[model samples]
Target: MGLLLKTLFYSSGFIIVWAMVGYPLSLKLIDRLYKGEQLKKDYSIQPTVTVMVVAHNEEKVILEKMNNILELDYPQEKIEFLVSSDNSTDRTNEIVTKFIKEHNERRIRLFEVILRKGKTNAQNEAQKTVTTEYLVMTDANAMMDKNSIKELMAAFTSNNIAYVTGRLSIVNQYVNEVSISESRYWDNDLAAREIEGRIQTITAGNGAIYACRTSDYYDFNPIQCHDSAMPLFYALQGKRAICNHDAIAYEKAGEVIKDEFNRKVRMSRIILKHILPDINILNIFKYRWFSYFYFGHRTCRYLLWLSHLIVFVTNVFLIKESWLYAVTFTAQVLFYLLGIIRGVTKANNKQLTMIYYYCMTIAAQWVGVYNTLTERTKPFWEKAESTR
Candidate 1:
């Protein structure tokens, strides 16, 4: 029992400390990379790029999305469009077929796959369908900014660029319930900005709203969190995943609090399925100060929250050092309860609200570990159902 408690204390303490230490290191690393040196100068030639969209039961919105792409200023010949329905039971197929037939003369080419390979498989299959040198993946619900593709292509000038992520703007936040719901839950606009401004890392990748080279395409595990996993994988390999703030895509946000919560939980599951134990030293150098900061600033910090829960629970009855264990466990529970109260109030102070939000986020992470461990698979995509 003493040995077990010792292990728990040491493990939790290490996680907490490591999470804090990683921040300053990441900042120093990012500073070095940003010093008068740009990697985009290497890709001298503009290469062929393909646009891929994965949709499931997006009958009402797919047509409008296709139209938006057609309005892009890029030469249709240099850019291609590939969209897959992934076993959609709605009129999604019919809508796509009509667009293909009507716009066959244009540079747009449409293909449909009926199998439900999840988002990752759909993206992989889309990559296989095209031999283009570059590939951009956008969501069916997202509408790209007029110059988004153009700006993204400009960044490829840096030869070291593997994957590029864009900004996602929730369209019409004024009155839409979905937009309002998103502003409070699931959406990471401010968090994304903080990451970009401080560490140059954007966690969202705006989902299907970003562009990357076909060669950099990685066949990640199907259930893995696509956005976070892909960028982190490349970043770990010592390449910077440039976050393009100017390149924007407008999409509908979650319509209700429940919808938003479900999206977060689904995303939480995906994240747990993917975060690996391996630590990359190259990632430390490539991102430099910011990378270290980000790992500490974001990634490692959350892991500590998970450790806190495990440690608190184990120390309760397993440790003979009752006073010390009780004190630590009590502190953890109190902080968590305070976070929950702050999160529930939804106050107007953005800073305090964000603090609450971050705390709740860690709480959600704990839930993720539990769900992942207990073999729970909430079948339907939570956010998608509302979008439908």
Candidate 2:
């Protein structure tokens, strides 16, 4: 019993550390050996493209988003804005229609999916109308950098490139403690994706700034995130899904930690549901070097909640074994204590709020795991309240 407990303690501890630290370090080592393919980026070429914005109830930002797209640096005639409405009952559809009529912008179009089957379903239904070869998908609140489209298209310099995702920056990162921590989290995420992109394919892409050829776009399960699934989806076919950091998009971070937590829960659950059923990822012979990264970046990090739980549970059992164990256990307890204190007192201390946000993140992942286990995952999209 003691041996098993010790094993659990050490093993879970390593996973918690590895998911947060070791994976990025290993990627840095891999970077030296992996010199990815050279790009033949040509800024002069303007391929006709469709910007697909999937919205549920986005009246708050729909018109502004349309304006942002209109002001983008892409050749005006070469770009088409396709707004895919997922059974939106709000003024989202009306506002979009009104904007198009007021400007007489033939380039802007709206399509609706009344089934409420979710964002993926909405995109799938709307995709039938896309006449362009390459499609860029963005959230309604995501504002593209002036040269974002050109940079994304530049990365697709060859047929071997499956997709190109851009870096995301939080426009309201300094709004609050939650936003500050979220900004830091995104910085780490962008760094990780940048490293993985250097390996020829990224593990995943986000909806805020992701682009792929219309022909290569998979009809994802209604419950799955294309952002989470498409990078691997294209990789399985020997195509590179690269990240272009020069192509940037800005989104407002949720002001409240709990709102952020719920968003993470939905994301984690959706990612797990999408990845677990695909046995192709485990076929090392097929994925080759990418299988190593998939395990390190996606699977290990997704299962972090389990590791956190095991480490916490086993720490209580092993506290009597050594002074070192006691010290470590006490440190863990105090970390949670700080988070709780800040939550209860609404304290303005920077350090404690950050700790609280981190704890809420882990807790959300645990809830995601619970939802996945209980078959409670749904095929509906919920926009963060603070975002729209």
Candidate 3:
């Protein structure tokens, strides 16, 4: 039992260290290899692209979404908008139908699917209708910059590129201190750097805007989360799925603090059940970076403050044996705990509110794991306006 515990401590410690060091090292290596390289552009041969949106009860902002897509700079003849209502009870379908009817003469092809389920079902239903060479999946609330489609298409210049993901900027930063801090967590911190560098696996942002070859796209089981499963499945196929820094889509963050917590819970459960569990061991060996990302970016993030406990207990034993080991372990635990504390407190004007927010995120992850393991049923979408 002592030997087993020691092995767990050592393995967990090495995994934590490798994850931190590997992220930057992977960035540096990819940058060195792809130096002076830019996305290849092919203006002469315009490939057909379909912009697919899966929405439900999004009447409040569905029109804004359509208007944003309609304003993209891509060729009208080359772009198609495949809109699915996903069994919306609100005026989401009616609004989109009216827009499509009015703009029928234009190049946009707007189709609706009314399903009694979540985004995964809507996306899978829309997949059959995509007749274009490439398909871009985006959320109803996701706002595309004028150049987003063009930038996404440029990455497809290499035939080996199976999919291209985008960066998300939270438009409603002033919503709340928690929402604002969450936005910064992505925009100002790790996400921005991950997108800028090459050989990306998974990124945490809107999960709203991503493009892929129509042939390469797979159906995510309705129970599965689209963002978590799709890219991971693509990775298993040994194809390059990239993150396009220039492909920017802006979206509103959660309406309030509790809304943000609910969102994290849903995301955490999906990552644990679908993404981390079924990953092929051989593929994990090949893309060890992604393996680390799965654990660091998704899995261990839930353990939260308990990570400090693990470090303290394990190192106390190692302390008498080697002072260097003790010092190194102490520094790592202090740095991460500090980051977590600062991240939480920064959510509001009060010094301690950031701590509350940090604990909230961590607690939400545990709730998610519990719900996932016990097979608890939770609604896919939340009534954010009601939360406000």
Q: Backbone collision count in every prediction? A: 16, 0, 4
Worst 10 residues of 1 by lDDT: 36-45
* TM-score against native, each model: 0.75, 0.94, 0.79
lDDT (10s digit) by residue, model 2, range 1-388: 9999999989888877887899888887777767654445778757899999999998889888988888888887788989999989999999999999987855889998878988888888998899998899998899988899999998887898898999888889988888998998888888878877776678888889889888887788888878877888788888988898899999888998767988988887765554344768788888776787787788777767778788889989999999988998999999999999999998888899888988888889888878878999887747788976
lDDT (10s digit) by residue, model 3, range 1-388: 5565466567666555544455446555656674624445554545899998877888988899999999999998889888877788888888888898888876555556654667777788878978999898888778899888988888676776677777777787777776666766666444424533254455332467888889887877777775656656766666656677778888777756777888877776654554356555236568655655555554555444345456557766666567776786777676557657765555346434454566676577677767877888453666466222
What ranges in model 2 sit over 4 Å off?
33-40, 271-285
Q: Residue by residue across 1-388, what tens digits does model 1's lDDT show?
A: 6777678777876777665444444445555675524324333345788888888888778999999888876766788888867778889888888888898887566566657757777676666778898888888888988777876777775556677777777765544433454565434344433344334444335584778888888877667646767667766666657766667888766545455556666767744534443455326555664354455545655575567666777767654566776777777677667656655774545454445555655666666677878877443363455553
Candidate 2: C-alpha lDDT: 0.85
What is the total number of backbone clashes in candidate 1?
16
Instruction: Please list the residue runs of candidate 3 whose C-alpha ends up more than 4 Å from where it truly belongs after superposition.
Output: 1-45, 107-112, 188-197, 200-206, 278-285, 288-347, 350-354, 377-379, 386-388
Better of 1 and 2 by lDDT: 2
**Model 1 TM-score, all chains together:** 0.75
